[model samples]
Target: MELKPLKGQHHVSAITANAKENYRFYTKVLGMRLVKKTVNQDDTSVYHLFYADERGNPGTDLTFFEIPNAGRTHKGTNSISTTSLRVPSDEALNYWVKRLEAEGVEHDGVSTESGRGSLAFRDFEGQRLMLVSDELNKGVEGGKPWEKSPVPEEYAIRGLGPVHLTVAKRENTEKILTDLMGYRRKGSYSTKIGEKQFDVNILETGEGGTGAEVHIIERPDLPIERPGRGSVHHVAYRVESEEELKKWVELLNELRIPSSGFVERYYFRSLYFREANGILFELATDGPGFEGDEDFDHLGEKLALPPYFENQRDQIEARLKPLETKE
Candidate 1:
């Protein structure tokens, strides 16, 4: 049976040791909007914070799961190594270079990647990230920048760009991406570490472009990553609706790929699975989004819980550290 292709990225979930600091950095320094403040459904003791462009669009979201006692990440291979955020143009990349410097954020000066300008940087907890210029993009359009962001609208981050995956066994992960997920190999680029150089293969799915691409770096020499604070938990790709997600669940079952079937995330429905390299991947629906329970102008202003967790609000609140998200 033929299945519809997966859309671009839905979101990237990462770990954070401190939700308050994560909130301040992404919202105040990076100028993205905090669209949802909730608890991780699987682990209610920690906070699940969603930051994105104005409306918390599927491909724009970069969320964090707070684990106060989490240790620092020991980075290596078999991981979602770096995530890129989209900005308007080459000029916007220049603006970020200066802004990051002024804000005392750690960043490498602007450079070119895959024929486009990119600035590599790290968050307070050392989470790897990049800001890629969308000046040459021709595929999946970016999201609307928040009008009230501290950064100017033109220079504010618009959405997620290509996500980077570092794995020890490229063929295994490549098979899952190509054969199972329907991603096509677009091309390859060279990356260097010390004196060693490696070819990073590029893959893209529906509406191929920066927003829909994935760069896989194979490093058989490195060890598997030990995830902690600032490490990516998983990367989710977009599925049009709950119906599409259900179909994906069935397809995974037919293929004998184990998955967490049909999870209702309130904002979206999802199915989680691990590919051959043990990297977690989630296929998620696009809607019934952030505005469902809050006014459009007041999203993330308070702790928002899914219907099933609403009854435990008092207990949840008592366990969480108060995070001020109001404008």
Candidate 2:
């Protein structure tokens, strides 16, 4: 069966030790809107919080799964090392440099990465992140910033940009990206990690842009990452609908790739599988989004559950510590 190209990133889910702190940092400090305050569907013991642009658009979401007792991440290879968020312009990145400093967040001030201006930083848990300026971008337009964000709309994060993946065997991941997932080899750029310089390959899919690209850095010297708070859980790419997602499932099955099959995520359907390097990849639909259960004006104010979990709401609520998400 012929398959359609996957759109840019749908969301990048990370691990956070404290949901309360995560909410405060992303919503207050970064000025991202808390679009959904839900729980990890597979494991309802903890919270699954989502932060994004005003409307919780497809390519904008940066979500977290809370693990109260999680330890700090042991950073190494074979990991989704860095996630980039899009800003409107190079000027916006300059604004962020001051804002982050004033807010007491340390960052590597504005510098060019892969021909685009970028600022690198980490959350309290040391979750690697970057703000890439979209001033020179040409494809896959960004989402609107939240009008109510603490940061000015122009400088607010617009959406997710290229996700950086570090692996031991570049060929294994490259084959899956190009031959299996249909991503094209855009180009490569030189980057330095500590004292050593390495070439990072750029891969892009549908309507290529910062939003539709992935940067792969091969590091055979490092060990497999020991995941904990601030570590990325998985990276999901966009699919149009359940119909297209089912087709992907069929394609994966035909090629004998093991996957989670189809998972109804309430907001969207998903199919999960790991590539050759053991990094988790999820293909998620973009429709029936976060607005369905909550009002546009008051998203993430209350604990939201999918219809299937409605019956267990009482038990679930009792298990979770109250998180004040209201503005």
Candidate 3:
């Protein structure tokens, strides 16, 4: 059975070595608002920071797990090799080009990819990043901007965009993308990474852009990637309701894909499973959002705890790092 095309991205979770440096590059450099301050749920010793548009909108969320001095990411198969943010137009991308260069950020000059304007760059810790100019899907990002950012809200990244996935093989993953998940075949393009050539097949969500793209590439000769800092931990897809999430769980079971059935993550419910290429994919609910515990105006100001961790708040607080916002 076919599942509904996901609403779009809920969040992209990655790892960073320095909490302070990660906070700086994402907010001060990238100009995203630090919307959430919390600890890793599984291991509360480290910080889980969320950077998004002013409102902490669903598709706009970019989160990090701070693991200081961790080894850099090793590139290979079954990994999200690149995360692209969409800006509205070529002029908006030009704005970023100047900003990155002015800030001494390393970037390749503006170029075109998948038939759209793109600017590629790396964060301080070598996380691959890109800014794509999407005229067709420009205005999809929801919410306002954090007024403090030096970046004019016009050129600020609207939200996450095409995630580039590398797999050792393609057919099974393509089935998962097209059959079970509700992505349509957008098209295919070829590019070279280093000396190796790759074919990227574009897949679009039902809602299309504004964090709705996945570019799947099969790199047959490469070994599997070893995850570390500067690597994407998982990409969470958006679902509208509990029923839709449960439907996805049933579909995964029917397809013989192992899934963690409807796990509660407090702010949003989740079900996790690996795609054929071994990249972890999460189905996350849209309701009971980030504003659940705090008021919209003051979300993520405090170290919010889950119900289980409430009693241990003081201890947990001491164990976690001293994380603060850009403001």
Candidate 4:
């Protein structure tokens, strides 16, 4: 199997201390759609929550695992440092600036980066986030609006944008992403992080759109990151079909890389592996999506369990916290 390039980010999964609070923050504050409510396959005691675009598109999703006592994140190398979402334009970013301010959500002033205006901020759990304007996202609007969302349609987030990864050095990670994963180097941009200035190398999936780009931050001075709440657990790349997924699994084995055997994830099949930098990466199929359990109109309205867990729904629901639906 030849190593295949990723189409774009399928969805990023993080660990959250509280599922209820995480749900409210993403759905109400960010105005995203709650596309799925399920439990982690590895740990049935925890809830796996998915927040995505209105239509539940592949590249538009972000997921979280509910781990109540999970502690704060320690930032360092080999961790997904930032998650960026694409907005329509500079005006769209301006709208968020004001809305975030009115909501008392702390954020940074708009600044230009990689030829686009960007606004940086953090979530309630201290996860780094950024809203950026890019040509690819100019006319892309979220699929459908939650009628009660405080944010207007025009200012709603389009989808996932470039994700940033900080590594001890760029040489090895660059090879894995560019040489093996089929990413093309876009270019480099310089940015300052406090007293020191560093170069951010931009690479894209070559698919040319939202979630296609990845920014690498070289920071040899930093130490390895510890897994905890608010830190990204793994980043998944989208593959169109099972054939493509199989090729990726074979590629990983051929390369002598460790990976979770192809796992059936209900909505989509997936295989997880750790990259050279120790960042967990997954290859996920794009079909048989969120609508598998409930139709579009009723998506995320109730707890959704895989067929294997359907019989155990009662026990699962009893252990989980209640997630409210939009009125």
Provide C-alpha RMSD values for all models, in order.
Answer: 0.7, 0.6, 1.9, 2.0
The residue pairs in collision within model 1 are none
Q: What's model 3's lDDT at 238?
A: 86
Q: Over the stretch 1-327, how does candidate 3's per-residue lDDT look in tens digits? A: 545668777889999999888888988889887777888887888889888887677787889999886797887888988988877678988888889999899999898888888999999888888988867664245446677666887777767888888888888788887877878888899887788776899887766764787898888888899888888999988898888999988877877889998888887889999988788999898767677777767766788777877898989988766776524
lDDT ranking, high to low? 2, 1, 4, 3
Q: Please give the CA lDDT of all the candidate structures.
A: 0.94, 0.95, 0.82, 0.83
Residue runs of model 3 more than 4 Å from their true location after superposition: 1-3, 138-143, 195-197
lDDT of 2 by residue, 1-327 (tens): 777899999999999999988999999999999999999999999999999999899999999999999998999988999999999999999999999999889798888899999999988999999999999999899999999999998798999999999999999999999999999999999988789899999999999999999999999999999999999999999999899999999989988999999999999999999999999999999988999999899999999999999999999999999999887
**Which stretches in model 1 have alpha-carbon errors above 4 Å?**
none
User: What lDDT score is found at residue 225 in candidate 3?
Assistant: 92
Q: Which 10 consecutive positions of candidate 2 have the poorest summed lDDT?
A: 103-112
Q: After superposition, how far is residue 12 of candidate 4 from its true place, in Å?
A: 0.9
Candidate 3 vs candidate 4: which has greater TM-score? 4
Clash counts for all predictions:
0, 0, 0, 0
Error (Å) of candidate 4 at residue 83 is: 0.4
Candidate 3 worst ten-residue window by lDDT: 136-145
TM-score of predicted structure 2: 0.99
Q: Clash pairs of candidate 4?
A: none
* C-alpha TM-scores of all predictions: 0.99, 0.99, 0.94, 0.94
